[model samples]
Target: MEKQNISVGLDIGTTKIVAMIGRKNEYGKVEILGVGKSKSLGVHRGVVNNITQTIQSIQQAVQEAEVTASEKIEDVTVGIAGQHIRSLQHSDYITRANSELVIDEDDIDQLINQVHKLVMLPGEEIIHVLPQEFKVDGQAEIKEPIGMYGGRLEANFHVVVGQVSSIRNIGRCVKSSGLELEGITLEPLASANAVLSQEEKEAGVALIDIGGGTTDLAVFKDGIIRHTAVIPFGGNVITEDIKEGCSIIEKQAELLKIKFGSAWPGENKDNEIVSIPGLRGRDPKEITLKNLSKIIHARVVEIIEQVYVEIKNYGHEEQKKKLIGGIVLTGGGSQLKHLKQLVEYITGMDTRIGYPNEHLAGDSDDDIASPLYATAVGLVMDGLKRQDRKAREAQEELQLEEESYDDTESVEEEQVLESEPKERKSFLDKLTERVKDFLDNAE
Candidate 1:
């Protein structure tokens, strides 16, 4: 029996590292095989700060996933994000020597490669070169330029850049954990793939992934990504605020926020309070739910406002750039109570929590389908897609080779006929003669 293709997604996040293993079922939905998570101690704000701890966390998560799935894991598609990640738009063009030649994939690849050669600030490297739109010989907005006759080809690209040192640290961790880095994808892009629908993207939408250390925003219009931004603040900052505001331990603060925190202070009553047990026989401390909400609300608002400013910068007020699909929020931070309402109110845009269940099998674990796993799920989806593409390309190459061999065989047969002029036996005649000779020899 042949083994099914499986893909692993490793999300090295700020507060936690997650490893997910999955494969597409016959019905075209992701069937999760296993999931593993561990508290992150080495990463902060999406960048790996402590290599040793990050490697340990990765190994732990990968081991758990391997145990649950009953398979050996070797490679992973990792998600990368941080304050060091930034994107810029640039227009570039290539002049062709032959004016009458039709544009081909090679031509497009050359153009993209040219963009990769562009110089950047020291220590910064381009991570993604996403082509927005193409122009052929001064003709504008050509989505597919192949087979079009043009002397000059041009395109606008959204290039994502990140610090080299930060990227290398992640690679080192993955290598030290004994796993190959199959690919690296932007976290927000992965989240969007897991949650956003085609119709939403085509109609213009914004995907906000509020992870532990970063709030990533991706804006899409007319099915093309228009903008991407990573805000340094995330759920961790909110927890920090709660810890300071309430004078509680970090662990206790995290528990309190998950259990009682709300982004909308108005939703909580002033009289509602939760008591935290004191350490070492000290008196228990009281925390009002209303006050907790206020603390959360302040940080959440700041994060939202920073993200909203990016949306505005995208010229959302302009009719062409308006995001009709509004905003879809994902990631663990999005699980907070009343966050959707708060975002809607603040941005004046329709909002909803993004769950990864859209592409999951019906029987997938409920926990894996939550918004928190969107990035991991999306990474697996991306890996599967890449596997399929490679399979298709391999098949095409095989077919081409077979066709070439057949042509060569036909030419050989013709040459033989021309040289000897002997009548060749039909396939059936040859087989019958061989069988008769064998029988006669046996008798």
Candidate 2:
């Protein structure tokens, strides 16, 4: 199989590092060949703070995936998220020299490239430039401007930005692990792709990915991403609360949160309690479930409120910004008991747990379908889409080359009949120069 046909997704998250190997199956669904996970020791809130530990974790995950899939891994599409990630809206346009010429993909590409050149704050760089809408000569809200005649083309872009050092740290870890970076995608967007359906995007929806150290939000309307934000708190904070409130170790706190915590405090009975083995040799300490739920409920409410504030900032009061499809929660933290219910109650919108099974083959492992793997699975999907696009572009280039060759033959006959050798050489030289320039600018 071609190298492009196989893709790997590396999710260097706060709680764990996941390496997933996947390829498009015959049915056009992702066939997950193998998945490997390792405890992430160096990453905090999605940023690599310790290069050595992060590289070791990545290697371990990739080695396990290789063993399971029986395929060596090299290139991987990675996911990025943290408090440092931010997004904003900007409008840009370009004037065409020939107004009579219909706008094409090249025009759109040029417009996007212009937006990429916008000056950012010091130490910041644009991660994604998503075109929200387009306008041609003041005609607004054009979903696609291709094949339309226009003198001035404008577009509103949702640009995601991040800290340069944070991104470089991730790159360093990937390089030190002996892996090539295929691509880097925002974690929220990746999770959204893995869990959201076309209908949901069309109807408007909000995706909340509650990972170990950060909660990511991605809002979509009219099939376009409108907003993205990263909250600094997540499941790890709740675990910290548990540790402080219950006076327990980090491992025990995490275990308690996962096994017995609930977002709704009222659901837990006062009489229900669990005992934790005391450290060293002391008597076991009993903790009431209701109290534990109360602690979790407090933290969960804060996170939900922060996320809802972002949702409101998207102009939710306006009819166009209303999310009829409501909120879909994913990631490891979304598994907290009654989280969906809590989100619905607080935000007053429909809510559901999002599993990353939408694009997976039916025969895929159950573990791969969990919300925790959403970002990794979506990264693989992005890789496959990119590969398909490259293949299509290559095919079109080949066809264009054949057509140009045929045209050249006819032109050569005309030149021979006219005996214009100088004109032919000049034309051929110009064409060769143009081809070189085009190839140089292709990427």
Candidate 3:
């Protein structure tokens, strides 16, 4: 099969590594072909800690996905997020030599390239430089600048930055696993793509992707990304709190959290108790469900408040920047019971759990449509989109060549009008043409 028709999304998270293979169906929906997941052992807080272990995990996931889909995996689009990720706002302008010339895509590309040259903290590099609004000449707040006449072009940028070393580590791992790295996308943005619709982005919205070791925040307004942040706390922290508070093992705590954990402590009754078997032959321990919820509630609230602070920093409190679409939560941590209610109560905004099914085919598996696979789904979409863009670009190049050829053909036609272009013109033919043209003009 042609490689262009297939796309693979590799999600390397702190809790698990997922490999998803898919293709775009005729209806523009993504048809998931196969998915493979494995426990992540060498990653912490979304960053690679052990190269060998991470590579092995990636290979295992990819191999499983390959077997299921009956296709070889050669390249993949990957998601990246960690505490080291950060974003900032910046403004820049470029002066054009001629105001009479209308602004074009090239001009915008030039301005973006200029912003890319901005100095970063020693080890930090820019990941994405998204333009917010544009100003042509002195006119401001223009969303589309093309075809507008302007001497000076200026715009505000939302620049995402991350540690270069951490980025390199991920690249090395993918390469060492014998796979080509197709692209690296921010996890929050990927999750947003899978869950948030175009209408939501246009009306403004905030996406919170709660992974195993980190929580990612992405805010969109006026159909443009305005702000982004990464918090170090995630599901793992909540599990740690549960284990410590209940004096139980980590595995049991995780199972309990999945089975009975609630973000709202009020939902649990005081008499409800969960018994945990002790180590070796020791007596089992009894813990009240209410107490268990309290631990989760505290950690969940802290994480939500931190994300809220980021929203506030983006000026969401202002009428113009208010997120009418509110918040969409996804990723592995979003599955907690009553978590949506807790978020809505704390932030006072409408909240919904984001499922990756938004762009998937109607018959996609229920398990694959869950919020846990949102990042992987989005990455696959990204890969397919890139493929379309490349094909379109190639077509444009082909058309340009055809147009140029037509221009030359038109020249030959004009020459034919003066004489016979089908026949080679010798010295005698040129002299006869000159004599005939001179005789005709003289008459």
Candidate 4:
């Protein structure tokens, strides 16, 4: 009997922990299997400060998912992002030592491993070694170089690294919850995989995943990743501004941001006022709508400007790509009112909010399929790809093992026959042959 494949994505964010389970159908489309989420505790600024509380939160989320899906989960692909994330670019070249002159998969893998060995910060470890393009001798931007004659093989790559301690802590917490860690994918990479189009990547573009506590950005040019960065502040900061400005509690601030926040202040009606109930026995207060928008706009603008600075630091490399598709803003924070216009005004580039519905089938739950699930949904797609790769490798290994076993069995039989002595044909010989046949059948 054959077993069906199931993939689950567990996202640990600053404000919450989400677990999404999905499976691929016969037609190669992802179907929602289950979902679970819980408000995170003992987590501050996207880093886990207390492991025990984090583990409890994770268990709660996973249990809810299991109940909803009527299935038990043991492993998941996790998403991670924070200010501790960083990206660096480097190139490696190798000339074949012998006269084979043709490059193969091994050569490419060796060169990439060499790039991964590059020195990084003391506490950081490389997460991904993304190949940009392969160059043979002087020719550049080759997507595939296998079977091509090339004495010199070179590859341009983007090396993404993160704080080792931070990643290890997350792994420990997941392990404590009795879940196996598949891999840790950077949040921006997961979001980009969920929303960005191949045409946009080739034409050059920037993807911003704005979550509760951090805004992640990834730049793509010539169909390869050029830069990735994590800004430490995000939508939670806007909520905090509302709390401080209105003298309201944190819960009230979050509710206000969701219910009435705007990315641009000028878009709000000047005369509009939101009535707030009095605290305890105090008199009720009426807060101006424009004022709330003002506070939200100020914080969002700062985040967008930081993205612009990252683009600028990349220098003429930005000019070459031209970013015809401009920016694709995703994640939970991208849903703010007038955010597209705000980003365009600040970066001087076109902007649009990214939704992960492109790969989904007809009439799914609109709430779960929105930009907020970019990382979660992308993790499901990633699980599918990884499953296929592993299946293929397993099939090849099984075939090799079977062949070796057959050869060894045949050698043993030959040795036994060569060492045996021949006997005259008789009733005993016939009986022995029949007994051997019966034993073979029974076995």
Candidate 5:
């Protein structure tokens, strides 16, 4: 059977790896076909550390999703984030060959290619170069410089960088799982796309994705990503702190956090208590809800404060740089009770838990719309977009082939033209393959 218009998203999170299959419906909403989730092993803080186990986990998730969707899965879009990922803002200018020529997509591509050449610390590579704003001959703050005429094309970029070995490991795992990697989207950017609206991005907003092993921050202003940061701390630390503070097992600690965890100590009464069964056959232990809240509150505050510091570093305190949309939190960690209240109190910014329902079909499962699936949904959207791009390119190639056949009396010329568009892989996909080959050659 021919493959339908479906895109799959693979979110290799620290806590869970999810494979989500989806397609756009008639009403321009994303209809989720199926989803498969498995406990993530061999990955920590969003980076792959164990190839064999990671490939097993990925294959397991993909197989489950394929079974549910009743379709074969081949290419998948992956999400990337970790403590090692960092973003920097840089401004660059390009001297155009001709002053009379109008700016176009090629000009922008050339400028982006220039930014890609930036030197990085050893063992690191550029993952993304997002343009923030453009300037034409010092006429600054131009959002779109296309169609304008100028000798110098300049722009500010938000460049994301990561460890090459870590990224290569992820690529290797995906390939070993018998799946082709279509693309990789920054986890923060993916979640932001799923949750934040265009208006929020235009007015300025901060998106905080509190995942299992890391907290990702993406600050947007004037509809462009202005800054991005990844904090090493996340929900896992809170669970660990609870485990140590309460002298309980990791499983019980995670359950307690999910079931009754509160980020506001004042909201929980001291008399309210929950009992945890002892390991094996020991006596059950009783803990006050108030104490649990205190532990959660402490760690949640630490994370919010760190994110606040990053926001301030982005010049949010400045009158002109204020984030009018305040903050929108997502990810599995963001589901903690009273976390939004605590964040608002700490940052003095309006805060809300972001859900991925904005672009979902009306009949989508309620659980699928939760913040936990925000990155997965966004990756699916990105995959669909890439699929559309590929379709368009194919159609254009067909048209060119037909035109070539008409213009050329020789049949050999048409065959040559048809074979020319094979090198249409994504640049990052090529990079991943190149790095994989490099590693194999060293071995």
Candidate 6:
């Protein structure tokens, strides 16, 4: 008996590390096979700052997930984020090989490889190469070019890059915990995959992942990634603001944010106030609920406004007119009360909180379906996609090898014409057909 399907997702975030394993069930929906979570240490501002501590955290999370799933974990699709992550668009041109101008996988791969050679900063690495659109001889916006006849092929792509050192640190941490990295996907893209609908992405939308230390924004239009940015501030900043504003400790601030914070001041009642127990012999102070909401509202609005600035700087405003899907807010911070309203008010776009329930099993627990798990769930899906992709690539490579062998055999037969052999046409044809059938069946 061999393993059919199993996937794991490891999300290293500023506040916590989450590991989730999922597999397909009989009904075709993805079921939650395992879940693990641990308080993250050695991480700050969404990047791993201490490798050993992070490794311990990852090991614990993986162990918990393994026990829950009753399976051993080997590799994972890790999610990466931080302020240094960047995305840009580029295009490359390639001519068809083998004479006929038929665009094939080789041509597409060649164009992508060309873009990977594009220069970047001294310490950055290309994490993923995403094909945006293809064009044939000046015709714009072709999706799939394979099997199409064209004299020249060009492809526009969204290249995702990140700090080489930071990515290496993540890999080191995971590898230290005995797991190989299957792939590294940017956090915003992962969250977008988990939340955004194909129709919404095509219609134009910005996915805002409000994590502990950074707010990640992925702008999509025409169903392609237009831009991605990481704002250096998030829900944690708002909590700090509440603490400073009310003379409370950080832990108290976090508690208030979770218990009573609202994204908009108007959502708070006029007479509502939280009675806070004072320290030492000081008198207990009454903190107005409206004031708390106002503090939260100010920071959250500023974050949303910054997201707007980034979107505008990318010159995506015109696209927004028709990109009516508006903003999809996810992550732990997006759970703020009245956040959707605040985002809508500031960005003037229809807003909704996105959840990771798109592919969730109906019997799955409620905690697993929250927006905070968007990136985690998407990482698992990304792993599945990578496995399928690698399988296809392996088959293609073997097919190319077989074709090369056949070409060599033909050349040898032609050279040895003096010892001419019978054609054995039907027999050879039948063998070739059987080989094809074998490969097809194996797949």
Better of 4 and 5 by TM-score: 5
What candidate 3 gets wrong by more than 4 Å, as runs, is 409-443
Residue 116 deviation, candidate 6, in Å?
A: 1.8
For 127-223, candidate 4 gives per-residue lDDT tens digits of 7777878898789979988778878899888777777677767777887799877656677877898899899988888999898888898988777
Report the lDDT of model 3 for residue 162: 86
Task: Point out where model 1 deviates above 4 Å.
Answer: 1-4, 408-443
Compare the candidates by TM-score and give the number of the best one: 5
RMSD for all candidates, in order, please. 12.9, 7.4, 13.9, 13.1, 3.8, 9.6
lDDT of each: 0.87, 0.87, 0.87, 0.79, 0.89, 0.81
TM-score of 3: 0.91
For every model shown, what is its TM-score relative to the native structure? 0.90, 0.90, 0.91, 0.87, 0.92, 0.84
lDDT tens digits by residue: candidate 5, 32-69: 99999988999988888888889899999999999988
Ranking by TM-score: 5, 3, 1, 2, 4, 6
User: Where does candidate 5 have its weakest 10-residue lDDT segment?
Assistant: 418-427
Mind giving the per-residue lDDT tens digits that candidate 1 earns over 1-443?
12348999999999899999999999999999999999999999999989999999999999999999997889788888899988889899999989777887678778888998889999987777778899998999898787799999999998888886787677778877888776667788889999999999999999999999999999998888888999999999999999999999999999999999999999888899899999889999999999999999999999999999999988899997899999999999999999999999998999999999999999999999999999999999987876776676566556555656677877566544443422222222232233334434544
TM-score head-to-head 1 vs 3, winner? 3
lDDT string, candidate 3, 3-52, tens digits: 78899999999999999999988899999999989899999998899999
| Clash list (residue pairs), candidate 6 | none
Report the lDDT of model 4 for residue 343: 90
Among all windows of 10 consecutive residues in model 6, the one with the lowest summed lDDT is: 419-428
Residue pairs that clash (backbone atoms under 3 angstroms), model 2: none
